[model samples]
Target: MVTRALIESVLTRARERSRLLTDSVDDGDLVAQHSPLMSPLVWDLAHIGNQEELWLVRDVGGREPVRVDIDALYDAFEHPRSTRPQLPLMDPAQARAYVRTVREKVWDVLDGHPLAGSPLAENGFAFGMIAQHEQQHDETMLATHQLRSGDAVLVAPETPDLGGTPEIDTEVVVPGGEFVMGTSVEPWALDNERPAHAVDVPSFGIDTFPVTNERYLAFMDDGGYERRELWSERGWSHRREAELAAPQFWEWDGKSWWRRRFGTMEPVRLREPVVHVSYFEAEAFARWAGKRLPTESEWEKAARWDPRSGRSRRYPWGDEDPDDTRANLGQRHLGPAVAGAYPAGASGLGVHQLIGDVWEWTSSDFLPYPGFSAFPYREYSDVFFGGDYKVLRGGSFGTDAVACRGTFRNWDHPIRRQIFSGFRCARDVQGEQA
Candidate 1:
């Protein structure tokens, strides 16, 4: 049940996450675009405020807006990120003041209301929506930090070695059955993940852990990128256009490979999940390995379907929320843990890292559920549904738990290599062994 205390906690978390991004950088850093692919950090900050105002104050509480002049400046689709710096964006002080004002009024409304009846207020969904929104932008800002040229402004203790020998039984055989593909009970799940429906998945063998750097390096060593036979037509064209030899941020220095991470260069961690890889890269690797990517339904069945109980759990680890030992999440560490890490977080069928580490891309297009209905707004997921986009499941180190769950769905263009993505290969099961 949604309570006042829960609302306050969510608001505090959203505010804290925004502060982590805003406080670490200078005023100039906030307005300047770190990369043409992303909005200026300041735009995200104000846009956080703008969305909170739109959903919480104006839409939910029915209050007058504190400022309307800044709305267009924060409208994400209206201006491209490359062109954002040229716009008359708010100075740092103004942006802070604006977010502060919005937060104060939004809190007043929350305190005044019973937070029920209306769909937006029901189950504290609007507040949850805003919290998830801010956390998402915070992750976006962190990506901007990675794309930036300066020294690392953020730091965290390195993730521990969750060491274990890679299993020869590297894949799990998910039994063929009818499993619920989406959700109807999870209150905070977004519109696209709604109206749970059944899907009949034939038996498949999915990798126990996400594909690792050691494994992907082998593919590269075998000339996987150069050989046009391994890639799809669109992917091969992209590979030639971008000259992609390995995952983004990786380079071969004659003898060995080194990767740039948060303004520092280090030898790649062979055991960690191969991250920053695009869907095309994953697909090519799968083809090179003589396997195939899992369909969206196949992926979900492996992660959530609990054959014993005959129900889908909220996570691979069960219905409990993610914690430090359970999964690497909430920017606790900047990168993925080793592939064999987090054994306790594995699915019922022993599929590992199904919750966090990196977003696992599937061989499926972003599409609507059977009873797809646009809720609150269409821009959230509706506009992007088509064959042009690919679906990425699970979450990453930067993903906040408020924003991530087993039913959670993330999509991006197949060519996107920047925002902490990875994948594991799956193939049709023969008998019971993978």
Candidate 2:
């Protein structure tokens, strides 16, 4: 049953993150330009909240607000990012109040429809649209935080001292077989994960934990960037073009490595999961370590457990939201935890941190399954395919739980490294064919 809990949590977090902005400028800054991709923080905050209310209440529940001013207040079309500066803005207090009111209305509607299914039952595609839309905005918010803080190279947050021993090395070997990939049941799945179908993959062994800073650092120390042999042709080209040396936030301070995170500089934690890497970077590091990335099929197969055989839930650990002792998400500490911090989040195969901490890059290209069909927003998937894009799984520190799903697929070019992306490694068993 649909509940307002997830939506409410997102709004609350959005407000908290926004309040972190050092700039206390009021509504006048809402339409002011902060960056090429970011609109005014105030404007985005109000618009996103209104977006939730509009879809969940007005569009889905067939209810209209007495005040139609929101249509103009949060109208994104006429007041596009390009023309933000020209739009009249709302005061911060006013905008915050509006967001609260909209959230209340959305919750009221959601409460009324306790048994509401996916967006389909309420507002058709509108619910999904708003959800996806807000996620994109959330991404923008993270980027804006970096931009505003003048921290172009943010580092992963320090891992808290959680006393948990790493699971002794355990491996899951999924036999080569054909299984259905993509969403089977109707879901708020993005267009990219649509048109589920069967795909066969060879057997492989995956590490239980994401590659850690200590592990990835070995590649860097071994000249992973300077060594062209480890990279794909495209990757090498990107490396050369971007003047690759090390992770975006990493720097050799002569004595030790240091990283820039959340507008602050700090020493690199060797045990934490390596964040701020691109698909290409992950691939290069994997190759250097004499391993390869798991294909999406392989990744999913290892993550989802079959109850008949005592396998756990679809998520790496099980069907549960992350908590402080589990995955490092929802700004738990404002950054990633140690790579092996959460054994509870491990898959049946003992793969740890598969659901959160940092997104893991996969070997598979961003292509649709067989019989793929576009969802409501065609741009979501069809726009990105073999066009030199790659798939990433799990969610990052800044990602909300609603966006964190085992099947959720994220894509990016092989070289861009502004996100909190990381990866794990997979390899064929000793006797299996590669």
Q: Count the backbone clashes (under 3 Å) in each candidate.
A: 0, 4
Which residue pairs in candidate 2 have backbone atoms (N, alpha carbon, C) closer than 3 angstroms, thus clashing?
A: 155-260, 155-261, 208-351, 208-352
User: Model 1: per-residue lDDT, tens digit, 65-157?
Assistant: 888777888888788878988999888898899999999999899988877889888888898899888988988888888888777788888
Q: Identify the leading candidate in terms of lDDT.
A: 1
The model with the greatest TM-score is 1
What's the CA RMSD of model 1 in angstroms? Answer: 1.4
Cα lDDT tens digits, model 2, 106-210, are 667666664355545543345545666676566666656654544343334556646365643344566666655666553455666666666666678887677
Q: Candidate 2 local accuracy as lDDT?
A: 0.69
**Once superposed on the true structure, which residue ranges of model 1 sit more than 4 Å away at CA?**
none
Error of model 1, residue 410, in angstroms? 0.6
Indicate the TM-score of model 2. Answer: 0.80
| Candidate 1, poorest ten consecutive residues by summed lDDT | 160-169
